[model samples]
Target: MDDLNAIATLLTKPEPPAEAVTRSRGRLQDRMRGRARRRIGWLLPALTLATAAAAAVAMLVTGVITPAGAPASGREVLLMAAVSAERTPQGSGTYWYVTREMRDMDIPRQESWTTRDGRRWSKGEPGDPPGVVVPDPDPLMLKGAEVSIEDLEKLPADPEALKARLAGLQGRDSAMTASEQRGDPLFSLITLISELPTPPEVRSAAFRALATMPGVESTGAVEGGHELRFPYPDTTWEVKLVVDPETARVTRTNSLSGNDGSVLLSAGFIRVTTGWTDQPPR
Candidate 1:
């Protein structure tokens, strides 16, 4: 029923099983619409990568999670990301496009194009059964306080003022998680940096705010970028964001448990690219 999905192929990869790709598509659908996660068993991963993306996939690798007593390196890493984001040009197009794939899983890749008014179109790996281009109408969940793309664009660019704006918007929803209830502006503003379609200045503000948050640490490098870990109040696990400061994009994110301190891919995704494109969604 859609023509826009026929746009150029987006990713290069060996193909995956058709069944797995179909299932992945449905799960992705649930996420795009702001619905609660359906537990397929194993622990329910943290909500950091939930909206606009899934939790993670790889599991059970041992690591460490310690609060940074003096996080000079950590501060520097985020500050660098802030500078990089400011320098990077923000491009606009007819549709906002994102290409994401489940990490370490055999599921096929997925792509989406969101219209300016928030209508979304998604397609799974090539040659899977044809699926309709459904529009996900739900607004983004800013850890409880709902916001449209337009509202996110209006956020302030100054770090302190941006935190203040999110703080004011929090607590409006009664069903907010325990983390959201605690009123952590650092946590709330981070969604803006990682996945939202905010302006580069807004993202720069978020990175600066994250730099000053207590217990954030630069945990050394990964394959594509270095790992940045930070504590979340009232949660047993700290958050790990694998980011390339030069590009100012989060490549991967997941929770590091207090005990084992492992990075589990079963809970999140590897975001290949998210940006505006003239590419149409079928």
Candidate 2:
């Protein structure tokens, strides 16, 4: 009981230097802004709002006193993202081309193109030939099947219907164990849609659908944006979706493993620049 009391006392101890805390908060905010520009492609006019929200989060986490006004919650963030997506401008092109960066366990920076029709292409890194087209044998798989532009367009735009469809797919895969099947379908949907050239309305629907899922909780604001934590069924890792509420788009996503906080995968994708390009990728 004495040892337990000692641990509790340490946990409740006052934090160190206010100046240090303030500096840390500022750095975090700056990092978030930089990430927003790189990952989201564009910043919304309401970036000040995002800054304030991030400040509120820093104060809350560090036990610093903050001004009044309820900090945005996870559900509110998702819903706001939906609204933002709805207001986004649509694009037109002969072929949908998306540029993205993905970091998995092995690769730190893997830049690539995602095509609506599943054609593989990538921009060569510095010192490599520009516009190198590589044949990617991989298919754009969603919900255990290959997806095309037509498939994405056919997806339900209503939140409830979309949620139901995602939930229905949970147990349909016979190969997945029951535990593996319990993964958050809403997250999968978001990741898939972010990589595709979906219409603004469809993307909005995807955000709304996420808002309706159980266990979707906010971890408050971080550096780049607000984060939503989704627990996968029977897994130690949780999926975190960082969203820029001002732009109503996902800025970054990561799967964090175990108590040690190891990252399994991180992907940053944007479709804002995607359009039908008559010029084929070289």
Candidate 3:
């Protein structure tokens, strides 16, 4: 079995030593940070591939699984996120507004805002204009022909049925190769659910749906909050969702490259403030 599968199998067995968990988490975090600092472009591909292989071996030796059948750790986390999302007050407004700060390895700090009605505004740097609406299609990209806020609201809350519908939609994308289409269904579903301006129930259902996917793993608690990770499509990097257990809402989503332990991308709304104001963000 691979590292992930080994961890899953071990999770079904007995708990590893607390020391082992610490070691595993430390190794993963350290490796990610080290990769982020390196700037050599050509060596990255080889380094990433080698890193993924080494990580699998490290997982096996570290024995990172919790007690088997003791309730999946990831499922519990997701359930909590679902409940938190359900309780979160959806602001009353003609349009939904989200503001967030983004940081990457070499990129300067950027602040941005997005509206549910498909408008994007941003500030380039600290001294730049606070807000200027940019003509961009990214917000609309969140809603496809079949999957929209309206469509998501109609989706069944049942996990299995919801997963199946997401799978069916995968084939509708004519641009993807057959191999890509056959990749992880949960990835697409989660991406769509996370980005779209869906109802609270729909958002809740999405988390609940993810709880049912096999091989999902929980990293217990990290610096900001609890983390639940899912394997990505043909990549060593994992898709990580950081949830504030106290509030049960996802604070951030990260594409963590396993090879160099660097983050490929991170996205989330830092604050969502909505009201009946027709004026655009100033």
Candidate 4:
């Protein structure tokens, strides 16, 4: 279909090569789309052609091949990210500033600044327009209630406690439809960690909470990120996120595929920049 949504510019990955590819190459492409995985190092020039051909034939005959060792699943990847996030130094300043854009939408990018204590918030317009200080409508959803930045600091660091606290937020989320209320609470956690400046330990707890969620699964890998799919109430389409495990940042909301082909859908704001800033919104 020629619909814009069918080819939305979400996640902003490099375009695939236009030329036709062979089946062996197609196999590799399929793996990139979520399947068996194997990390092959550089092929030595001295290796015999027969040996290479034999390996190719084996992969062809037996679907995808993985050498010895446990393949990394989505949960394992998230757990690894949790550890990475745990060790990262936390940032501190007067305000937590954020720049975000909805890639698939035509609206202008938005910027925001919130006092560390969450007492005040401001919305910045595109270009040089001055930021308008707004009311404290920026409470984070947790345990079916609104939570301020001060409360965020006091959240439990334990994965299980954090999970219970953030998961139920989705039920009370006004943005979610009645049907969406039945969706996974991981959605709430992911949204918070992706854009909000939660404490490093709290972010780690959220990652750990997601790791233990029942249906979180590795869909595949993306350049500079790992893609994981989560359960949503809607069955018509799938929800996947491209996450940078090193920084524990969710880079993109989703990259979905269908019978026709893959459709890149970006439903949420792409966090362009977020961290503590001493300077006021410029």
**Model 3 lDDT per residue over 97-165, tens place:** 443334334434343445544465544433454344443333323112333345656866555566667
Candidate 2 Cα errors over 4 Å, as ranges: 1-68, 99-108, 114-117, 123-132, 169-184, 255-282
Query: Candidate 2 residues 1-282, lDDT tens each?
Result: 442223223324555467765664565555545543222223222235346544443343323333333346676676656655665676665555644444333323333455555675555433335455665554555555455678767777776666666656533354343543664455446644455566776777787677666788876655456767777656666666777755665666653221111123444322123345656666
Each prediction's RMSD over C-alphas, in Å, is 17.5, 13.4, 11.8, 14.5
TM-score of every model versus the real structure:
0.64, 0.60, 0.56, 0.61
Off by over 4 Å in 1: 1-72, 106-108, 124-132, 171-175, 255-269
Model 1: residue 179 alpha-carbon error in angstroms = 2.1
Model 4 pairs whose backbones collide: none
**Model 4 lDDT per residue over 79-112, tens place:** 6566557657777788787665565667666666
Evaluated with TM-score, which candidate comes out highest?
Answer: 1
What lDDT does candidate 1 reach at residue 86? 60
Error of 1 at 240 (Å): 0.9
Q: Which stretches of candidate 3 lie over 4 Å from their true place?
A: 1-72, 108-131, 142-147, 170-180, 256-279
> What lDDT, from 0 to 1, does candidate 1 have?
0.56
Give the per-residue Cα lDDT of candidate 3 at 200.
66
Q: Per-residue alpha-carbon lDDT of model 1 for 115-202, expressed as tens digits?
A: 7787766666344345545454444557555566888788897777887787667444444445556566755665676656778878
Most lDDT-accurate candidate: 1
- lDDT of candidate 4 vs native? 0.54
